[model samples]
Target: MNGVSRGTTWRMYKKHKFLFMMLLPALVYMFIFHYMPMYGITIAFKNFNFSKGIWGSDWIGLDNFERLFGTSSSFLRVLRNTLVISGMKLVIVFSGCIVLALLINEVKAKVFKRVVQNISYLPHFISWVIIGSILVEMLSLSRGVVNQVIEMFGGTPIYFLTEKYWFLFILVSSDMWQSIGWGSIIYLAAISGVDPALYESARMDGASRIRQMISITLPCIANVVAIMFILQIGNILSAGFDQIFNLYNFRVYEVADIIDTYAYRIGLSEGDFSLSTAVSLFKNVFGLILVIITNYVAKRLGHTGLW
Candidate 1:
């Protein structure tokens, strides 16, 4: 049976050899940059030494994990922040993108839709470093635009970046602002594929544009939404490292630090490669588990999955 399966697969591949050739570059790129680096994951199990290399490093078993679980460890705090921030982004960013895509689709004026889309996409291309500088200037304690407006209304200057609750608000709202337009591209594409007859029928049934979006457009693109949601669930622990790192300071670390930033700080700043790798390995493993479970639930609920 296995031999028959192999023969069938080989024949199919041979028929599509040109297509496979086109895919070869991506396969090689993934192998070189992603798969080949798996060997370094062994660093998580060893007490790494510069002189010894990965293979020769002393075995530490679960010692590094013990430190993560130890009292006085900051792991829990960072992990909590990661979850909180990611959860908010999951809700706000997804809704923002979906709504933006639907609204843009409803617009009959092509020029206005294109202008709004271009404006929204412009921010996604901007580097977080530049965005950080812009945010600091816009919300600065001294002479910032936001504070200037508040002063105009006789309100005191509010330090937004340093406050915990406000910092989280900034993270979620900024993520939504940066993502809404660009992230909606996929949904918009999916919406375009929907049969125009469906919308016409809905209109004939006395459905408003909003009703058509909610009843027809959203349901039509449910697969894309499910797939994107599942893919993002796998990165739940990540929580936007560039944004948080650029925006957060010592004052907001208690509320803003996440697994990636914690791993980066420990690995480079403190020179604890093994512990940092262990932390990363744990996060990846958990993320993988989350993906599997989420995919399973999605499939059970009659949605398409990554698999």
Candidate 2:
């Protein structure tokens, strides 16, 4: 049976040799960039050393994880912050993208729709570094636009970033602004793929635009949304590293410090590479479990899943 299966597979490969050739570059790229780096996961199980290197380090087998969850680690605090921020983003940004896509699809004016799409896409391309600097300037106590406007109304200037709740608001809002358009692109494409006849039939049945969107458009794009949502859930532990890193400070660390930033500090600054790798591994394992469970639930609920 094995011999027959191998021969059949070889024949199939030979039949589609050119198609496989077209896929060669991606396969090679994935191997070199992604698969090759997986060996570094060993660092998580070893006492990684600068001199001895990842391979030569002494095997420590889960000690790093023990240290990670130790009382002094602050892992629980960072985990809480990560979940809070990522949960907010998942709810706000993800749903906002879908709403934005639906609104764009309903626009009758082609020129205005295109202008809005282009403008929305522009923010996604702008570097987070520049956005961070802009935020700092716009929120500055002495000369910031927000402060200036507040003072104009005879109100005291509020330093926004340092305050925890205000910082959380800014974090979630800025994340939404940066990502919504780009995120909506997938939903827009999915929306475009929905048959126009469906909408027309809904209209003939006296279904309003909102009703059509909810009943026809959304159902058609639900699989795509599910796949995207599952992917997002898989990275729930990530929160937003680059944004928070650039915008956060000592004052807001309680709210802003997430798993990635915590790892960055310990790995690069404190030189605890092993614990850092373990922390990452811990996060990724939970992520994988979430993806699997979510995919299973999605499938059971009659939605297409990542598998």
Candidate 3:
């Protein structure tokens, strides 16, 4: 049986040789860029030394991790910020994308739908640096358009970017704006795959457009939504580094500093490579655990999830 299976596998491989050849570059790229770099994770357990390379560094076990978590509540603060920002994005931004996708799906005018989609997608292509700069200018207390509008209504000019109270709102809203259109693309695809007959049946049952959407559209796309939600659980610790790094300043560090920015400051700025690696490892492990738990719950609830 083993011999026959091996022969069959070889024959199948030969039949799809061209397809395998086409996949070679991606395979090689993942091997080189992803798998090869995994060995560097060992640095998290070491007393990493710049003078003595990664291999020459002394293995310190969990000392790096201990130091990371023991450093005068900084790690805890950073962790809180990460969870808050990511949670907001998960709940608000994800739902916003679905709502926008549904609204777009409901539009009858083809040209208007295409234009709205195009406009929404444009912000995703813009770099965080550019968006951050634009936001800073637009939210400037003294001369920003927002402040000008507020002044016209006899209100005080509020510092949206620098103030701690408003920083999280700006971060969440900016991220949502940048991502909603791109994120909605997946839901739109899922919506398109939904059977039109379901809608037709609901309409014949005297269901209104809103009623059909609630009854037919949402249920059909529940699997896709579940999958995306499960995938997002794996990123709970990430918290959009580029966006935060580009936008946040020292004034709002208490509220805006996340794991990624904390790692950057510790690893690159302060040269504590081992501590940084330990922080990153902790995040990856925690995220992995979250994904596993969430996926299990999703499966139990009879929804599709990332395996």
Clashing residue pairs in candidate 3 (N, C-alpha, C atoms within 3 angstroms): none
- Better candidate number, 1 or 3, judged by TM-score: 1
lDDT of 2 at 65: 82
Clashes of each: 0, 0, 0
> What lDDT does candidate 2 reach at residue 86?
97
Task: Write candidate 2's Cα lDDT for 135-209 as tens digits.
Answer: 999999998999999999999998999999999999999999999998999999998889989988988999998
TM agreement with the true structure for every prediction: 0.96, 0.95, 0.96
Alpha-carbon RMSD of each model: 1.4, 1.7, 1.5
Model 3 lDDT at residue 167: 92
Q: Which candidate is the best by TM-score?
A: 1
Sort by TM-score, best first: what order?
1, 3, 2
> What's model 1's lDDT at 209?
88
lDDT ranking, best first? 2, 3, 1
Ten-residue region with minimum lDDT total, candidate 3: 64-73
Candidate 3, residue 99: CA error in Å? Answer: 1.0
lDDT of 3 by residue, 1-307 (tens): 9999999999999999999999999999999999999999999999999899999999999998878778547999999999999999999999999999999999999999999999999999999999999998999988899999999999999998888879999998899999999999999999999988888888889999999889889999999999999889899999999999998999999989999999999999999899898899999999999999999999999998787
| lDDT per residue as tens, model 1, 1-307 | 9999999999999999999999999999999999999999899889999899999999988888888888527999989999999999998898789888888888899999899889988889888889889999999989799999999999999999999999999999988877788899999999999999998999899999888888998899998999999988999998999999899999999999999999999999999999999999999999999999999999999999989
Model 2, which residues run further than 4 Å from truth?
Answer: 1-12
- Reference-based lDDT, residue 46, model 3: 94
Candidate 1 clash pair list: none
